[model samples]
Target: MEIKVSLIISVFNGEKYLRECLDSVIRQTLKEIEVICLNDGSTDKSKEILAEYSKDSRFKIINQENIGLGASRNKGMELAKGEYIAFLDADDWLVDNALETAYNEAKNKNTDITMFQMINYKENTGEEKKNDWFNLDKFDKRFKDTVFNYQQTKEFLFHLSVSACQKIYKRSYLERINAKFPEGIYFEDAPFFFNIWLRANRISIIKEYLYYRRSHENSITAKCDEKFFDVIPSGEEFFKIFVETGNYEIYKEELINFAINAYRLTLNSITEDAVEEFYKRSKRQFKKIVNSPYIEDFKKYMSKGNQDTFNNVLNSKDYEEFKKLNVNSKGNF
Candidate 1:
């Protein structure tokens, strides 16, 4: 019984949404799917829930000490015997029949990766928002059905999704590139995904929102971890991979823009108590970028506002005043 799609789910104390998440995978129309779950030392009843469903046979569960999300996914990938791979967070669920469509498209097109969209669902208010990583508006109508890597240059990089969960990856392609998520880091997907997109020669974009990415205050996405400024390391890896692949000079502009946004995102989200320390660390990161070869070229490609902000930060090193400006704009500049 060969697996067509190995859906890897990484969980840690995710009891509240665990049942619904498992239900979605178990009910997927794609019968050849295998759900590989990593129970990363969850103290909650998550392990109990997993045991309840282990009889499904297709569900493979790994109970391990608390490893971060990246390591959990990596362990599941090692155990996966599927031809295609998909990722699902423990708190997120998939659309019924979504697997069938994505799998068929990947197989039929022989794509290295099948990219899809997600519905950003507000758990509290039930508000839905678009999470189209492909930015379909930029798609040339003639190439809609074509393999993107063949039709577009790294131009498609402009809308690349840093999150890995929304896409279906060909197992062989991943193995060939020796691509594995870096473990023990928050937001590990950014660098892992950047490398995948660089190595993926053929990608198919499906416009459907096949996954529901739930939003909640408890989610660490909006929190700054004093334990680790994962983005600084991730962003550095982002740039290193590009330069190593000889794409730094070619896609320099888009890459720089992505870096700026990445930096700003983390800097803006830091908790007030941790701001001083985080700012020092972030300042070093910015200086590294500014000193990179051909970095002066980066300023020209930056959006006017971003350019000015970077200049101000480089000159004044005043994250405090920058915070004041953001406060004035109601926190989104």
Candidate 2:
């Protein structure tokens, strides 16, 4: 039997790169797939370009008001009619064999999700950097590793921060848990990863680079803002479940590594709320790692800027001191 996959690509005024993204999808080596494009109120030629592709049976378009990327993805998930689901951003393109590789891996492992590596590209200079999406070095792929339950998967959940566009998921798993992207948040992928890993029975990792993440001017990931840090609330809520369940005790090391990477990313963005929120979470989790027991190896990778912020939060009497100075903050944490 042929495997059918629904590829959800959410667009919001992505006129500049929409054609190239669609071309990449339509040229996928795995031809048994449908491209579901959700136009989230694009006030550009994105809608016109998408309309042209609606003529193809393999392509479907849903025109809706500006509901944000998360809601647009949820809307696509609702209408998806495939056994497997893959998410692609309108501004990014994928490798030709990505879908075939991910789907085959999931089937062979009997896993709920399969993730692969990605390539990050600079839109202006055309410079490229490869990203190991899962840090699969932790797993022995030569053998069949049986992850009995969701808790076993949390060991790998932190890696989901790498990127959502790199993975393909089983529709039944998502349907069983009613999984959908959270609406109106910048980091919609974060909560989805947390919740899915909590419910997913098995996850397989593919180390080969398959997704290309284009860093363009208007891309949300390329831009920074206060509202972007709105994801902290959801992060806190998800982390609470992680700590309470303690299903991830074995992966504390990975969690700290994840936190450090997250900490650095937030700091580099120079957003006050992102900085403050990371400070708060790291402070709360400090006791857990104070003894250098779980994540000693990652200490070297910590940036001077991050270390400074961490120290400031640890020693400073007031959080408002730095917030008052950030141009983006205008006095808020």
Candidate 3:
């Protein structure tokens, strides 16, 4: 059978929902698809679950030591035989027609990337909420049912969702760009997603929520630790990519806004123990932003609240003073 889509899943001790994830792929309407499961040193019943699913011809499992999600995904991409590639977390499941619909849309438009929407599933309350961030029309009406390149949509660059799992890429396009996730990082998706879209000549959108992103305490995003600092390097990598590609001059304001938003999110999520170090790192990053050639543009583009936050970062001598400055303010801005 010809493989139209190769769904790559990196499993690492995801036994709780591994079966459901595998089942969703097995039940995909698109039968001409290959499921690549990278068992990244799963010690639990995950291996047995994968073994059970490996009975199917389309399901191939690669058992290897834990090399982190980014590296495992890179390995899966290297071995993928399908025309297009998609990623799914082992704890997340997909809608039955996800692959089929995305594949049809991608083929029909001859797009380098096909982006879609995702629903967040809360493990505690079983609540499902559609994340509107993926709704292209919300950013601009012209984006609806449109096939366009990065330059055409550059104005809304920062507004776009960076979740790699919410999109599918043409295998040839990925190979041409030598696209690979940043290994040994927690927020690798940001760089990978931005790099692809920036270089993609043609991209399409599927507004349908095709993927279910599980929200649980065990997930990496829920934890507040050193890994949260990974967002800093991830942001730097993408910013550097923009500069190297000569797009920085065109989207400096957007890129700076993206960095500010990322820094704020990190500040809000990180543990108290990480405050001092994170503050230092963020202050360094903000210093670069203020000292850049586009400092005037950054000032004009920044909101009053963000300006205050920026000033606090630059003026505060220590994290203690920084905390005190925003102790009563909402969002710590």
CA deviation > 4 Å runs, candidate 2: 1-3, 134-162, 240-268, 271-333
lDDT string, candidate 2, 15-86, tens digits:
999999998887789888888999999899999999888887889988889999888888888888888999
Q: Per-residue CA lDDT of candidate 3, range 1-333, in tens?
A: 889999999999999999999999988999999999999998898999999999998999999999999999999999999999999999999999999999999999999999988888999999996655755444456777889888888766777788999899999999999999999888999999888988998998887889999999999887887787888889889988898788887887778777777777677678888867888988998888778876797788766556667778788899888878867555464
TM-score of every candidate: 0.89, 0.75, 0.91
Instruction: Write model 1 residue lDDT over 52-114, tens digit each, in one string.
Output: 989999988889999898888888888888999999988889999889989999999999988
Question: Which sections of candidate 3 miss by over 4 Å?
Answer: 137-141, 284-302, 327-332
Top candidate by lDDT: 3
On lDDT, who's better, 1 or 3? Answer: 3
* lDDT-based ranking: 3, 1, 2
* Model 3's TM-score against the true structure: 0.91
Q: Roughly what TM-score does model 1 have, to 2 decimal places? A: 0.89
Candidate-wise lDDT, in order: 0.79, 0.70, 0.87
How does residue 258 of candidate 1 score in lDDT? 77
